[model samples]
Target: MAPPVVPEAIARDYNEGAFVLDRSPRASAALARRCLEQVLEGYLSATGSDLKKQIDSVKEKVPENVYRGLHGLRTIGNFSVHLNKDTNTGQIVDVEPEEAEWTLEVLDLLFDFLFVAPARAQERIDGVNSKLKASGKPLIE
Candidate 1:
């Protein structure tokens, strides 16, 4: 079984909405983190991996590209979660609107890729395969 494709139109609309909202970079980052957390929870549930163990295992099994994606989410998520502190401490020195917009876009991409797309695909694939197996049907046609 494979996950269904996410329509480009939906993706575009989602991105556009985010842009229209003009959310602060910090808010975008927080939302991205929440999305990532949902994906992680779904992955763990599907795989039946112990939460603590899975977190540790993912650190090693994730490919470089995937790790990079997660890192982006983490950075943005952390930024948003600690926005006030970061801003006050001068950790986030840039306060320009454009820069903030760019940050939001990046975070949105990260969340969509890491959480929404993959999870949905995996769920679809798994569900189809499970049904076929239960019906005593071969996976391949």
Candidate 2:
């Protein structure tokens, strides 16, 4: 599969606002959830393991606090998919913008660490050296 494109707009929003600032919280949350789903699916596909089992294993492998944080993110993502609605008004009552931004930020970091950084770190370092040599910009130094 082709690599995922990190959303430039979201990065810009994060850089400018110190967080993701798009107002569509539900959409952002859904996107973050989708990213997590993709990662889990990829992991399962590679390892031929069930996602739930893998998550359980991960919980055992990680520290309690870290596992709790992951569990909380997973819960937020799951609830963002299944809950957060008013039956009468047909409005979403629980999905918060801050929560969505936070989820997205965490997902971005996870993706960068797990997928992008390992794949591109060497290339980026070389590119930085090349650019520095060409322009004397001291990109690394």
Candidate 3:
């Protein structure tokens, strides 16, 4: 199974974002933002009524870089939601060059920090403990 942090539904959202990135960067960015919020809400139990507040709630718990990335994704996603069109001209305004792509990159980093690293560390510990059990030695606590 995939990592528990990103359930299948969330992954699907992220993939859908990637699939439509070229045609509609704003849409892609919106999806990325949704996925990030889901991860924060579902896994971290991030508390707050809105994305910005939720991110602020978790700020002290995560490293500076991770916190910055979360805010970055939030900012970019806000652009997708709030700034996608010209209010006066009624014309679509595309995301800044590579801005949509950067959201995806930030998600990858968040996933690595919150999920993959912990799971891999547990796997290594289990492997070593199994050997210790076989040899009648105490397991690593």
Q: For candidate 3, lDDT tens digit of each residue in 22-47?
A: 88888889998998889888887799
Per-residue alpha-carbon lDDT of candidate 2 for residues 50-119, written as tens digits (9 for 90 to 100): 4345455555444455445545556666656676667899886666777776775565555565557766
Q: Estimate TM-scores for all models.
A: 0.45, 0.52, 0.85
Output the number of the lDDT-best candidate.
3
Tell me the deviation in Å of residue 96 in model 3. Answer: 2.7
The per-prediction tally of clashing pairs is 3, 0, 0
For candidate 1, lDDT tens digit of each residue in 2-66?
11343343344335435543656545445445544545565433233542343444655555555
- List runs of model 3 lying over 4 Å from the truth: 1-5, 84-93
Model 2 CA deviation exceeding 4 Å by range: 1-21, 44-54, 59-69, 84-93, 124-141
Best-to-worst lDDT order = 3, 2, 1
Candidate 1 clashes between residue pairs 3 or more apart in a chain or in different chains: 1-125, 2-125, 3-121
Q: What is the lDDT, from 0 to 100, of the residue 74 in candidate 1?
A: 55
What TM-score does candidate 3 reach? 0.85
